[model samples]
Target: MVQLSNNSALIFDGLALESYVSGKRSFMRTPSVSLLLPSPEGTRRAFLIMRNVTAINPLCLPAKAWQQNVAAAVRPAQLPGVQSHSGCHNQTGTCVDDSNAPVWQRCWKQVCQNIDVACSGARLNSAGNPAPTYYDINLLDVALFCPVVLDQACLDSLGPLGCTLLYESGAGPGMLPAAPLAVALGDATGSQGGGHGSATPLVVGVIVGGVVLLVVAVGVVVLLVRRRRPQAQTAKTGGAPFHEGLDSLGTRSTTSAAGTVGLSMLPTESTARAFPTMGSAGSGATGSGHAAPSTWPLPDANKRAHSQGSDTTVITNQTPIGDCEFDVKIEMPPQDGVAGACVGGSAQPDVQLTGIVLGRGAFGRVYQGIYNGQAVAVKLLTELTVDSADQACEAMMQELEVLGRCNHPNVVKVLAASSLDAARPALVLELMETSLDKVLYAKPGHLLSLQLVLHIALETAKGLAYLHPTVLHRDLKPANVLLRDPGSDKPVVKLSDFGLSRIRHSVLKTMHPEAGTPAYMAPECFDLTAGGLTHRTDCYSFGVLLWEMLAGAQPWYGMTAVQIAYEVTLLSRRLPLRPKNTPGGQVLERWPHRLSALLSGCFERDPQRRPAAADIVKALALAQQDLDNLSRRATPTRTAVE
Candidate 1:
């Protein structure tokens, strides 16, 4: 049995010594622990790797005390009963002895049991259960025994054990020499204890002393490295000046209720009505029955004409008599000059801009508007100039073309568009209550239930699947996903913001410059020369989005976008699959194995290995069913309590 110290700083098993170390003074500053176990060859020599250590202690000891205690433990004289096992030889005939076999077995058994308890606790806590102790185990191969299922079983069974048999590479007992100080100390302790010597107790103390020295050395090296390493500045979430062009990178900004645009704030009815009505030539005709062309000169501000006897508003321009009104004609036509155009000479429905700012993007500002009495969102090109107007117009046209093809319910619908001038064009679209990013960051109290997350995931996959053959949503972050009826009990998610979308064929043919929010960007996006954007790129972003929803925290929150891009693409580091000690961690614990596997598949670095949207949809559906059943079972228990 392994026993925890009163403060939980040290753990004691009869076979080995394990102690927690505080990393507050070291770089990375992550708390770590050290465990020393006898080598499989029945020797006191052991190997230690000082990377990726997990904190196992709950006490959280101070660095000073940890160092002091650790230092004291490494002294040879301080160790008790450490002696060389007799009859255990490094001879040609035999290295193993009968008397020493049982001692090694007991020692190995205790070490395995302690490891099992730690790993099992970690796994249980990861699944959302409140385990008494928290343990962070490094499953990396640097450790003598990786905690794989088969190895764990072997450890439990005390089966054939050796570095050669257990691991592919690492120091084995045969390769290392026994510590002379430890062996001498063990001999001294054995002589002092009435000359009744035993190898097991002596070996345990010697091993403990060696581990102590190694840990101290590693700690000092880690401290020096940390002091020399430059600290990366983290982006502040509060009270910092907003960086220019940072808004374009999908960063959320402060907005107010007064920002909402209502119908009363729009241009006067007559002025709004003067814009050309395509397919109907006389649609702008006044009450006097004089037909006016859609393209007409602007009226002088001082010239107000009164209507005669009929409350009919007449807008007359103050132009000299015989002056042609249609001096600057502007052609307004639907895309391809056909689809979505007024059919059978029907009058175009009037749309009024509410002047409310829904949100601002890199090139446009979305507003609340009323289209033919139905609420809609209006995306108006902003900061346009003679030089950039053509570029903006092209982008608007591209989005229109893409949105025109996508008719899925999961995708935002484009209602209408008018490009009276390339400099000032507008697109009316289906209005949504809020964006997923706003729901996640703005409202902390109202956390999304697991069911809602699954629903959103399913819908997002469906939308992507529908767009796969033709369109690629180059930027697929949570900010672009809008939630409809967000205040309602059952909110629905829809994909929006197609400005960065590209036609799949076009993306493949040309090595276009990378464009996207870096946090959600895939590894391939960092290098366009490797291969142009593929449908799998969207899948990678989706995996990050899913992780954000589950964790309820931005991925790599402290790191800058560039830093994240570099680390993720070049260094190949990924965010932890499960959050530590957060509400999101609780949710992740309840995640089904298949759901976890699906997420893993989506995040595969190899684009070709990633599963298609269809597969993701199917997997989410199964996960949703499992969640539903769990909810049903919990409902009865809640009712009984109430």
Candidate 2:
């Protein structure tokens, strides 16, 4: 230690500041000396030792020796019920260090307040569990330091004799340094949240910044999307200009003209701006007049003129724009006596084929097709006994009722239907190629990756979630599932074929004659005595479907339909698989344990035990997140490969 001749001291080594410094900071060395604060009783005083003195000239002292010297110099305070000690000893009473207690308590309270603020601010604990924040060391640093400073300031404000200016001062209000300036300083500088009124500006700034970014991104995207949309429409049109005169004539045309028929004509610019293609009708013209002469190489001038001449006769008979009464031409099938039907021949064009048969049963055959040139699958009801046909028609009507009300990506879409011929009713649907059965069994060598399986489960649950608890898919099976090429980062798996679906308004009354795939049939189906067509039946079917996805095949097999039903009913045989691998073991051996447990829950023997599809979706999504975390580090197991 160096003592200047001027009675000043210098210390640099191992010095823990007992109080906040008052002025511009400077280091000095001091001979181990005890400092005192006068007590309430003038004769008594609080004493503490300063240690490990180092002079400005680089003098040093062993920390322990310095501590000993400081201890020797300190005098115990003579306060009632208080025991004071030198430098480092544990001391008790008002005379000892309660200096930091209030500060720490205040800091702790703020920590809890901050947590509450975060919870409320982020909207966590809402309808669903909040997505977790990524662990951030930077935020932690801020959290840790903010309180430490507050605690120091809290101590300083409560106690006197410390340098208040250096201790309490901050760059801004409410950001006062509670602790040492060194501890308080960080790379970050900003007010976190202000008073209620002040908070608005910061929030506004953040929102404005976000909105600015969003607007910029949206603008760029709109520009690109605008450019691309027109290009796409033009390309799809085969470079035809349907809107050339649309702006001036206030007429509109669309690519749909190519869908139902070939070339459709429009009146010129003074009359109608855009042309209608084949079969579609417009307000000004009758749709049925001369069909385009050829499918390919759309009509040349001579051919068009010839067709126009023929159309003039038909147009003359049709109503003009202003006429209250007009004979509008309507497209109708050419008049012919109904073709004689062979016993097994398709009744009219109710059923069409694409050679890709998805499923066939006693009820009907479902084949993928190109309806109106857009891909669709057509289901033709097979001839059945009068009673079975009636039952099947009833089922189809119920399905149509349910599907019509539902508009979700995961649920199958019902398009056009032909009920005109009760003998051969048909339904047209958007085509989806991959069926759960095809995914499970058709491709023998492929393994059901954990990711794809979870996705299917999630999507199925989503579909079920859309339906009220009263409605149920009585016939949930692999065959009922259809996959679409969603053209996305994570393309979706869609559920299709609502044919055995039922919507019961309530427990009061529901259709009977229990039916569904045998292997997927829930045990409740066997309980004909009790009505089993509730949502629980769907749950049971879901369980079986989950089992199939996990197992990569149907749960039960090798029996006639009757025998399978008997076994399912009498044996109470659940899917014969577990999460582990053995001969005929659980589905994918590599699936996550949590996912396996979730799948088991779906297939539970008791209907009441099963989680709702919404909960299931939540669980699967969580599992998917876990899988995604693992996926980011490596190629995801759930790539939607063709």
Candidate 3:
């Protein structure tokens, strides 16, 4: 694992090895990383090199490699603008095409052509300019090459002379040194100049070179005699000596932390198989530890285990459903109050998750996921759920069944869904930033304004109105309602969580195995003896929802489920019509009394007396108009000069 200064890293997990002197192929590809390096002087200053004993695999590394610190430099082969020709210095007067190119060209072109070789960088300097990032797939131990996976495709591109690179011989074979005066000699001789006309200049250079060499030799002898000490021995790492950070040598580190990547590399002659989302299967042959990416947010019960590097919510103590046994079919929703006939409809496919949990609920947990390049929220069953794993699957499937048939603005749109996981079925939905409950309780005493409250109420009612004819949202509450742009004045409301919702085909809908939050459950829900729940059951919940929005608190705050059930069912009581003892509570009082009166109707103990979703929408609309008209008259407008 070589971590680039700019967070770009080149990692090798698993591969076989070959010796450097006889190495022909390179397994590691430079384009796999994105690196940006500063070029203050500009013009191709440095490029990357991956010289290693083995294919960057931890399993292949010996114990000594990890024992002590070894420093290796990621130095470039050529000097700045030296213009050195190819290494193929043919004694026979035969010309080859690639023989005339620069020193690093073979390593550069050999890197995959499909990949964009030039880096579109992100790291910048004081002037806000990005550094130049270059890659040369020449990461072979110059002195000790390793056997790689690729047979011949990854071989060095340059011909026979290409085997010897600049790192071994400074100016490349048959080329003049890049030193100060030596550079002028090469330039005068020219790339193809073989005429005797350059004899006089060559003769003058030899005399000057001899004199300069004598003076430098004498100076070195005096310094060595005075010091009388031997040169310090480095750890003698495989590559050049290097350090950390963005310096003259660049960000590439030669040696890094060791880890294994299981390539399923077989001793038999065969190619390895890997996917985009490959799990880390290190070679246990070396006892190297590894872990899978923990993108999934686990439940509260599993939080402690997760903190200690354990896996996220895994289904246990439950039966798993393999091939989904449930059959799915849906009807096209009614348009213009005319219901469409039943038709063959298919359920959505299962989605892959990154294991990141976003939110959790009674029955299901939500995880952040991506589908077809779009971010989505995938709902899966929690470790500890509403009832059993079976019920959780039932609820997820039920929600999918309902959402598949409906397409309304206020309703949450389902992108994909599948209950094949059985114990942990998935429901992928369009990602919403926040939920109404999250925003409402973001801070204590953070009350919603009259306009904002009505906006939510109106949208929620419209969604209910759309669903009432065919289905009923049995569990309606703040958490179930999603908000798109919560920061804006008019945030869009999307009614979600249809697990408790059921198709209203029967006049008396019997909610068997009765399950719902007792605080929001209608009074009729408590008594199974009374006529089973109706569309108006949602009306009771809507009434509580309004009170919650107005007061910025729970309807029966600090009360247990049993206490709430006793108070609502046995006592037949509803929340106060006005938001009492709350900040911005007076905003509701200032509004027209019609909204309050509508709330009273929604809370009617008798299901028949409660307003239907359609009627509630009409009443909220009227109340909105009255409030707006009152605002116009109350405002003191600029008087015209008479």
lDDT of 1 by residue, 420-447 (tens): 3434577778899999999888766345
> Model 2: residues >4 Å from true position, as ranges?
1-359, 367-373, 385-387, 420-422, 486-489, 508-513, 559-573, 577-591, 632-642
**Top-TM-score candidate index:** 1
Error of 1 at 267 (Å): 76
Q: How close to the true structure is residue 30 of candidate 2, measured as C-alpha lDDT?
A: 20
Candidate 3, residues 243-352, lDDT tens digits: the string is 12232333222221221111011122222211111111222211123321212221232122211101111111011112121322222334587753322234443344
lDDT of 2 by residue, 301-386 (tens): 12222121111111110111110111111111222554333222333343335556667867877767554547776666765687
What candidate 1 gets wrong by more than 4 Å, as runs, is 1-349, 385-387, 586-590, 635-642
RMSD of 1: 34.5
Work out the TM-score per prediction. 0.45, 0.42, 0.44
Name the candidate, 1 or 3, with the larger TM-score value.
1
